[model samples]
Target: MRIAHTCANCGHDLSRLCALIDPVYGLPIVVCPRCREAVVRTSIPVRTRARQARRLVVSLAMLAFSVLLTTGFAGAVIGLSSVVFEQWVRAQRNSAAPWTHEGFVVAAAVWAGLALTAGVWTGAMLAHWRWWLVLPAWVAMLFGLIFFVEVQQVVEFIAQGEEIDVLALATGVVQGHSGTSRVLIASLVPFGLGYAVGLPIGAFTRRSAARRMWRRRRRIRLHRRNA
Candidate 1:
């Protein structure tokens, strides 16, 4: 049985690529299309493969945790805002409060700003430049939120002894509430944008600090040697 191999650099499967024998060392090699790294078949040990698998698992776990934290944070913010708005409307004794459109736009803007701040902090803390990873988490959060709201609405409708049309409800949620849906979707854009902006800055700052420490250690060692 032929063993499958993956590129250490980018995790691209080597088995899919055409294998070539190195002329100098007579070793089987494959060039990874994603990162263009030449992976030698024999050079990869079982331990290395296991380590890579562990790293992948850890990365996936981190992403999942990030998504949950972000979703919860966003939910809390929106919930708080809604409560405040309701309280204010109640105080004013206004039946027709301008919360339908204006409230949603304001909430979206606030969420976007909060997301951007959170993304920047996360990027700086992690110091890894894979900004596009935020998009998948954002999409997951959006869908999860939608599913939750739909379920709640369905439950309430049933409680009211209303006939349910799943298709029509979904259509109404997407089209009738287009403004709300658009705001919800658009609010997540800033986080990704902020992460992209922050990652490079964070990485550069980290590298600079590391270089300074290295140079300081090198200088101390040279001075001691001379002494």
Candidate 2:
């Protein structure tokens, strides 16, 4: 019905106990698993600092990879976007149709937000991060790609000053829509696929690092004992 326990580290007395069975360790901490601190069961804040840290590192790495891969593989599109889209935005801002310019700016902002969100989501998903985080990340990645690849194409066309070749550019992207839609769709596949692909890589990397950390810690602990 009841068990006696104390903080493994601090040895604080706990009046009540929880019913948790860590078959490996075989104990519940009055020292809460939350804060990894000794508590009287008052408010053991569930500190996910370690998880969050791992997720953060993975998020950053994924973001880098996502951007690099997307940019590298789709250099033309990305480059065109940088050169074409921004210019269009500026032009729109100055033009009589200023609202169009605002749209362009809004579109760019959306893309940026999506890229970041995607990076973070893919990262966390791979890290086996919480559900609350996973969905948002996926959305961000998808949206980011839509804006980055598609909208960029749109700007390029506006800048080209050439007669629009409906067939030349509209390969896989814009089926019903125009050339830009095609570009967006092209990127969207990988952008979504990235989450799936990025997950395994992220998980693998995180696991590898954690394993190394565990080994190093064990070695040090052993060394201290021998000494």
Candidate 3:
């Protein structure tokens, strides 16, 4: 039997990765220390698609938690601002009555672009620059969030005794959306582009870092030889 001794988190080669006995399962599992915490939190190994699916679930849960946290924070800010400025909430509701779909499209594009950049960067850092691991997971997460919101909207619409405009329900969460097909394209394209760009940029970053490390090591070795 081939012994699978690879990391369950970052897919770092287990040659240098450490091994530990899983207390819960009472089994010896080899994983990198960098991702040891994640492995411990989630006993599912990364060696199989089954485990990857579990990781995706965990990631979805985390994304939901983050969204809740952000929503709460935003709510607090709005509440405080309303209290301080008395007419703040009224002004906000009244001021944006004529927002165009194009404006919303631009906003979505900008938001998605920034989110993708930050998420990919953080994932790369956490996964030790493994773009392969990072990109797929990030894409899954984005899709998961989109799916969750769409489902919620559909549920709410059904509860309201309204016929679900499936297309509009999917993309209507974006403020001022009229559920037009164009709005869907505008909202989705940026996220698609973001996902597309993440891999190449991550690859470039890894290559650049490797080159810099090589040069630094070469300089140190030369100096040592001269000394």
Candidate 4:
């Protein structure tokens, strides 16, 4: 005895007629050949683009949230550590600086590491974004945050009624652009290195999830076959 399949859209019986069946990728779908052709022609490409755009938006949002969250956490940790270390250093010697410039550099590097790692992982898990995409998103997030902070400061200067020096402003803008470019490269390079390790870890996790789902579906099919 053959199992009957029904059309997904029109609910027409398709078991004895020309039908298209697709069960591998997502939900099992049975439809008339005409409907399948129409879907191929119109809905599929539109849905694909829409899905990609949605995922990209979600990834960017997650990246932003993770940067804010992890940066706050790192800042809190650094603040506490600084206080404790400062006390210890002060007790040890009267001449030692509380936080050295070298120490500040090290702390900044650590914070960057934390921020990038947290952002990439959270965004990938939530958005199902490709691993390669995360690096670009990370770079964009850094530039965006930096731009926003600088732009806000510029606006505040204007609000304070400071005399605007057009030449000075132009020079600052040119210099700022140069500095931002350097910062972007410095930040993105280290973050991209992390991506090498992180990408595989995320891929393995997603692949394992897919395997489990496939196994479950296979079992269901076997059970139905027996029934």
Per-candidate RMSD, Å: 15.5, 15.1, 16.3, 11.9
Better structure of 2 and 4 per TM-score: 4
Give me candidate 1's TM-score against the actual structure.
0.40
Q: Alpha carbon lDDT of residue 105, candidate 4?
A: 48
Candidate 2 residue runs with Cα over 4 Å from true position: 1-126, 138-189
Q: For candidate 3, lDDT tens digit of each residue in 1-227?
A: 11344555676556444344556664445556666533322222444467568879997997787666534433332233223233323345566532333444444444445544545444433435454664455444444454665688778878999887767655554432223223333323443454455556656777897998797566445434433
Model 4 stretches with alpha carbons more than 4 Å out? 1-104, 115-132, 149-181, 219-227
Local distance difference test, each candidate: 0.64, 0.51, 0.48, 0.54
Residue 49 lDDT (model 4): 80
Which of candidates 3 and 4 reaches a greater TM-score? 4
- Please list the residue runs of candidate 1 whose C-alpha ends up more than 4 Å from where it truly belongs after superposition: 1-68, 76-109, 121-130, 156-163, 198-227
lDDT of 4 by residue, 145-197 (tens): 55565668877898998767767865675475563345444555545555565
Which model, 2 or 3, shows the larger lDDT? Answer: 2
- lDDT, candidate 3, at 163: 82
Write model 2 residue lDDT over 108-158, tens digit each, in one string: 555444444444445544567654565454444434554566657777877
How does each model score on TM-score?
Answer: 0.40, 0.29, 0.27, 0.40
RMSD of 2: 15.1
Q: Write out the backbone clash pairs for model 2.
A: 118-141, 121-137, 173-182, 174-182
Q: lDDT rank, highest first?
A: 1, 4, 2, 3
